[model samples]
Target: MSIARNVPFETTLQVRDTCLCLHTQRAARALARRFDEALRPVGLTSGQFSLLNALNRPEPPSIGAVAQLLAMDRTTLTAALKPLEREGLVAVAADPGDRRSRLLRLTGRGQEVLASAVPIWRDLHAAIEAGLPASGPDNLRGALAALSQPALR
Candidate 1:
């Protein structure tokens, strides 16, 4: 014998269909799966590709800076970097300007991997955008950007 909650099944249906967080999470996971499949040939998950891409700048960026851009916490970012570092794809060093701070950069091999991944990313991105409904990719990106803004909190 099980006790039933006060909430009705209709409430669950409503949330399943209309909740922004649920929809966003579902969509994000789907996109990640597609990218991960596409990037597998290069031995990267979508998250790893994104991390390596972020470090492809002219100058090395601080860990805090990259963490902010990636919308991840410092500890999480550090954990994510471990595999890349072990593979000799990313180098993390103390920032000369601030010894306590760490800076991140892609190694030569990382750049080569990212370079190969770019065309794959471009093709899939184009296909995804082209297949979107009337709201379009730009509008979707704008909405996501707006929601991601710190001011929203």
Candidate 2:
């Protein structure tokens, strides 16, 4: 039998330094942790804050639409909604235009919670931006938005 060749350690180091997915995931997790701590007093996680913020529009969006915006699958979104629903922070109802399609909305309690969380988010976000290079925050956001495009998937 032919012997298998071993990959060089340098190649592993190169991937560790250069892989976009790895870097982004690490940053995402760190950011999530920071926000989670900041939001603890309000009893919300970063993901929950984001989900609630997305529903802060005048018109409620369909589940599919919210899933697309959040870059999550229907099942995952549905699972995430359970706790919020149980807390009476959100309501999922049949869309008036499409009976089979469900719409998601923030309840008054959700609005109250979100309002309470806003200043905390704002301060944390400002601190994060301040810690970045002068142009880093905008550049990083643009790069992330580009990567998050549906076409990229």
CA lDDT of each prediction against the hidden true structure: 0.95, 0.97
- What's the lDDT for candidate 2? 0.97
**For model 2, the run of ten residues with the poorest summed lDDT:** 144-153
Q: Please, what are the lDDT tens digits per residue for candidate 1 over residues 1-153?
A: 999869899999999999999999999999999999999999899999999999999999999999999999999999999999999899999999899999999999999999999999999998999899878888999999998878843
lDDT of 2 by residue, 13-86 (tens): 99999999999999999999999999999999999999999899999999898999999999999999999999
Total backbone collisions for each predicted model: 0, 0
* Residue pairs in candidate 1 whose N, alpha carbon or C atoms collide under 3 angstroms: none
Each prediction's TM-score versus the true structure: 0.94, 0.94
Model 1 regions lying over 4 Å from their true place: 1-5, 151-153
Top candidate on TM-score is 2
Alpha-carbon RMSD, each predicted model = 2.5, 1.9
Q: In model 2, where do residues sit more than 4 Å from their true spots? A: 1-5
lDDT of residue 135 for candidate 1: 82
